[model samples]
Target: MPLDVESLRSHFPSLASGIAHFDGPGGTQTPRVVGQAIADTLTGPLSIRGSSVASERNADQAVLSFRSAMADFLNADPSGIVYGRSATQLTYDFAKHLSTGWGPDDEVVVTRLDHDCNVRPWVQAAERRG
Candidate 1:
């Protein structure tokens, strides 16, 4: 279906306030279901289980759920997926892995318009490896 602006707006409690939030580059908001899912994950009974078989199952299910969601979102293989706090953090982690075995003569190029998060980690890694 086409973008349901009103339906999507109903999900975000933050949008209910009269305040405006245009701090980021993108002027967008997440659906209420997304926020509710995060809240449920953090505060739900699934997290309070002791180290028992049931708890282990719950934890495994949570991981599988996350992996499946991520794979679907990115159209990527779940096995190749690695989760990070943000794209910057993820890029840094990938840079560390990909930069291994680089020689002193190696050079790296980073974009000017990219976030500092994306550039800083690769620069630091190149310096260390050099």
Candidate 2:
């Protein structure tokens, strides 16, 4: 089936405001349902993930549900689903982990078109490995 671009775009309320957001650390525009879910979770009765208390159970369920949904979307195992505070942090962490197996013979190439956050992590990782 053909993609419904307009229908997908309609879900993001920020797109209607006619402002382009470019801040990498800020975050991308989220859909209305996603925004609502985030707001609800932030304002909801939440505690440490557990089953002893209602708040804890709710928080635990929310995390499990998110992991399940993301796993389904990515066609990956839910056990492997990882969440990071930011893309930059995740990239750095992943680069560090991946570069452990690199040798002096290996080459790490980054393009100028990429953002600094994307480029710096791999460069630093390669330098560390070398």
Predicted model with the maximum lDDT:
2
Candidate 2: misplaced stretches above 4 Å?
1-8, 19-26, 113-116
Q: What is the lDDT of candidate 2?
A: 0.86
Per-model TM-score, in order, reads: 0.66, 0.74
Q: For residues 77-126, could you state the per-residue lDDT of candidate 1 as single tens digits? A: 88876655667678788889988978999999988876577688999999
**RMSD for each of the candidates:** 4.2, 3.3
Error of 2 at 130 (Å): 3.3
Q: What does the lDDT read for residue 15 in candidate 2?
A: 82
For candidate 1, list the clashing residue pairs, or say none: 11-32
Model 2 Cα lDDT, one tens digit per residue, 1-130: 9999889889878888887566444356777998888889879889888999989998898989978999999999999997666779999999999999999999999998777888999999999989
List runs of model 1 lying over 4 Å from the truth.
1-29, 46-54
